[model samples]
Target: MITQTISLYNWTNGVIMIAIFGLVCLTLIGILINFMMSGKKKDKTEN
Candidate 1:
């Protein structure tokens, strides 16, 4: 029973870590996309 509990805890921890990592990655991608779009707009207006 103790072993099972420990395994469950480990699984939950891993899932939480993965979720956090995914969120960070998504945020970075969003930032990069926004930056690129704004840059293109600026370039178009300047040209």
Candidate 2:
């Protein structure tokens, strides 16, 4: 799946691929952080 995505980006010479991957990674990281923080908040509130 990843290889196919990279191959598709080959048409754009990799610039768009890099940008897309960067944004995707950042979004994923942000979502993970948000989940962790929300879980912590819920635990504290239950106490």
Best by TM-score: 1
Could you tell me how far off, in angstroms, the CA of residue 38 lies in candidate 2 after the best superposition?
0.2
Q: Model 2 over residues 1-47: C-alpha lDDT tens digits? A: 89987776575767877899999999999999999988865455767
Candidate 2 Cα outliers beyond 4 Å, as residue runs: 1-12, 43-47
| Per-prediction TM-score | 0.69, 0.61
Residue 4's lDDT within candidate 2 is 82
Candidate 1 residue 23 C-alpha distance from true site, Å: 0.2
Model 1 scores worst on lDDT over the 10 consecutive residues at 38-47
Q: Rate the local accuracy (lDDT) of all candidates.
A: 0.88, 0.84
Q: List the residue pairs that clash in candidate 2.
A: none
Model 2: number of backbone collisions: 0
| lDDT of model 2, residue 32 | 99
For model 2, state the Cα shift of residue 15 in Å.
0.7
